[model samples]
Target: MNSRAAQLQAFDRLLTIMDELREQCPWDKKQTMQTLRHLTIEETYELGDAILDNDLEEIKKELGDVLLHIVFYAKIGSEAKSFDIADVANEICKKLIHRHPHIYGDVKVKDEADVKRNWENIKLREGKKSVLEGVPKSLPALVKANRIQEKVAGVGFDWEEPHQVFEKLREELAEFQQEVKSNHKERMEAEFGDVLFSMINYARFLDINPENALERTNKKFMERFQYVERKAKDIGKSLQEMTLAEMDVFWEEAKTMDKRF
Candidate 1:
């Protein structure tokens, strides 16, 4: 039965540790946002891996690592007389209160979709000229495509139905195939991108998150591949020596397993 105050105290202790590191550790003191940028991205991916693996303990540890980075940045900002962690927290707090007007104010939202629509509208009112303004340009292409589609959808630009999106996906795929036949690498890449974008739109129409959907497929592929490896080992054969027919046996077996979900 931990209280909110106890959690705040724990966070304060973490902030204190970050401050000590910044003051006494040469490496920590010498670091800047530019230096830590890649490390932050790596930590974020590690956190994503932990989440996908459904490892709660690992997620907690990775979250602490990310939190430490937040405090570390805040400590550096404090030294430069810019801002502190409190200001960062307060800013987000105010933003959440403003965004979730259904809870904080008298605004009514019918459902989660309505909440999302309101959130985007509020962001626009807060001075974002375009719905896509907040999506990072450096995001992975698949993720960026999904976010871009979602952002555009928030502003009322989207496909009417999943079936229509599916047809567009097929059209893109056909165009990509034609580009491949003509050996036009650039056009092939563009058409392939269009296919992926259309598929993401279809997923959105079906109320699915493209990122989560792809992550699930990634996990499934890993499990199935591992099954193939294990089957090969049990048969005293190496994967390199196994034929496609032999691998297909284990692949199908893996599909039959209930643990895939």
Candidate 2:
């Protein structure tokens, strides 16, 4: 096992470097919590991209970038005579001990689902107004819907099985199609949103992260499209100059090389 004291020393080194940079580096001295917000979000996405690509080296670098942001924020807090890095770390540490009664106390849990239930129940006891209140409002719609469903399901407010979710999805889709045929744009939009929300809920029933799954499909489509473009170049043609039939030959060939196949 790793030495825990060595890990603390490594973090202390980061804090020391942050201190030096704040005092000496012109750009570092200027950043505030508000100014760093967008950069932190961008760094987070880069880390996500590295994870999805399965590039361990890129993952390490992106993780460092995000860690730097954490230390930076803590340093800013220290400057304002507020909570610092130690406070941030200790707060989460205390929360973990509070939330994980199975480890920290005598509470018994039979499975992962029971643990999740306990976690939500513990939050309610800790003064959270609602389980849904924990979901970030800025989350992408599909991901947000999945999270909302999961939070409510923790308290037993959910369909019993995947088939019921699928049935609800089909109902929503039918309503959307009816509105489309009627050419009622506003009603169609509302119905379309319902269809999407139902589909996300169904995805949750399948134990899928809809956002990650869709991004994976998006990556597959991009790779196949790029391959089709390369094949067209080899044939002295461009996509704009080719008929659908001509382009689809390359598309089909690309599909044969797909990772799943």
Q: Which ten residues in a row have the lowest lDDT in candidate 1?
A: 252-261
Task: Compose the digit string of candidate 2's lDDT tens values, residues 103-178.
Answer: 9999999998899999999999999999998999988788788899899999889899899999999999999999
Clashing pairs in 2: none
Give the TM-score of each candidate. 0.89, 0.95
Report every candidate's CA lDDT. Answer: 0.88, 0.93
Most lDDT-accurate candidate: 2
**On residues 32-59, what C-alpha lDDT tens digit does candidate 1 reach at each position?**
9889989999999999989988999999
- As for model 1, its CA RMSD to the true structure in angstroms is 2.2
